[model samples]
Target: MANKYQRILLKLSGEALLGEQGHGIDADILDQYAEEIKAVQAEGIEVCVVIGGGNIFRGVKGATAGMDRVQGDYMGMLATMINSMALQDALERKNVHTRLMSAIRMEEIAEPYIRRRAIRHLEKGRVVMFGAGTGNPYFTTDTAASLRAIEIEADVILKGTRVDGIYDSDPEKNKDAVKFDTITGDEVLNKRLNVMDLTAFTLCRDNKTPIIVFNMNIKGNLKKVVCENQSIGSTVVWDQ
Candidate 1:
C-alpha cells in the first residue's frame, strides 16, 4: 500500500452508478465500488467523493426541454444527493466508515458541509461523501469536486470514468484515438480534451491539483491508481 498521495478526491459520474441497467443504480456495481474503496482506505489514504447526477437527472438536459434552468439544476443537485446516499449505504455495508455531507443544508439526510468537520472526518479515517453540487444553479458536480478538493487540500483528484483514460478522441468511437499516459492541464485545455468541464479543469490547473483519470468500473483499478501509482490512467497536472 505504498503511495505518494495521502488524500484524494474521487469523482464518480451517476451514469456509472447505473451499471448495466438502462436506468437507476445496479447493486453489483455499488458493491464493487465499496470493495475497491475499502481497499484504498485500508491503505490509509483519505478519500472524498463527489458523484454526478446524469444517471437520474441532468440540469442542462432539462433546460433544453424548456424547464426552468434554476429549477432543473436544483433537481440535478437532489439527484446527486440520492446517488451519494446510495454509495454511503453500500460503503457502510462493507463496514467502511463514511460521512455524507451536503453543500445545501439537509439536516435530515446529511451533515451540512463544514471545512473543519470534513477534515476531521478524514483525519479520523472516515470517507466523506459530498453531495449537492455547489448548492447553486449552473454548476456541475465536477466543479464541486474541484472546489472541495482544493478546500480540503487534497493531493489529487481521482476522476473515475468509464473510459480507461484520457485520449485524443473518444476511444469508444475512434479506434485510432491515442491515449496519453501523462498530460499537462494546459495541453488538455488546448486540445479541448473531454476530461472534465472547462470550469473544473481550470480550477485544477490554477490550484495545481493533479488529476488521474481511470476506469473505476474495472475491479482493483482504484487501488492500483491510488496505492500503487501504477500506470493505469492518464494523468493531468499543472506541470509534467
Candidate 2:
C-alpha cells in the first residue's frame, strides 16, 4: 500500500489498556490493540509504540504523597516494564512481529534502547515497543515518545488518546468544544495547548517532528494515521 509516512512513533495512554473498565489492563482491550497494530502492519508502515504506565503506577502520585521523587519514578519505570511485557505477549499472539526494548535494561525479557538496533528493527519491518519513560525521573512518557521519534527519525508521533481529536477547550468539561483539523506547534505553545506536556511539546517543536493526536479506540485509527490516510485527529506541526 502506498503510504505518506514511512515510520511512526505511537504514544498510547496506560488508561487505554483499561478499555472500558476505567482500570488495569483488560484482556478484551489487549486483543483489540493487537488487532489494530496488525492492521497497521498490513499497511506496510514501520510502527514504534510507547505505552504509559499510569494504569499500573504513577510516580508523581507517590511523590505528591511525600515519597522520594526518584524512588517513585523508578517504581513507575518498572510499571512500564509490566505493561510492555503484556503488550509484547498480546501482539505476538496475533502473529505480528514485535520487540520490547526498554530504556532501563532488562536483557532477559527485552533489549535495551539502542538507537541503531531500533532503527534496524524498523528497517526489518518489526514493530518496536519502547518502555521505561526515557529511563529518567521528572519526565513524562510524552517526552520519551518525542525522543524516540527523533532518534528513529520518525515522520510523526501519533498520540493515541481517549478523544477523537484536539479541542479549543477541554472537551470533557465543556459541552461545546471546537476540534482543530490541523494546528501548528508554535500555536500550541502560544495557546498553551495541553495536547502534551510542555517538555514534550518543546522537543517536537524544536526538532520539527509533527504530532498527530487522535483516539485509538476509533476502529483502525492507528493504521489510518500512520499511513497518512486522513482520520479523525488533530495534527501539530510548524506553521512555517
Best by lDDT: 1
Model 1 lDDT vs. the true structure? Answer: 0.93
Model 1: per-residue Cα lDDT over 33-70, one tens digit each: 88999999999999999999999999999999999999
TM-score of every prediction relative to native: 0.98, 0.96
Off by over 4 Å in 1: none
- For residue 51, model 1's alpha carbon misses the true position, in angstroms, by 0.6
lDDT of 2 by residue, 44-130 (tens): 889889989888888999999999999999999888888888988998988889988999988998899999999999889899999
Clashing pairs in 2: none
Taken over the whole model, the C-alpha lDDT of each candidate is 0.93, 0.87
After the best TM-score superposition of candidate 2, give how far the Cα of residue 174 lies from its true spot, in angstroms: 0.8
lDDT of 1 at 114: 96
Worst 10 residues of 1 by lDDT: 231-240
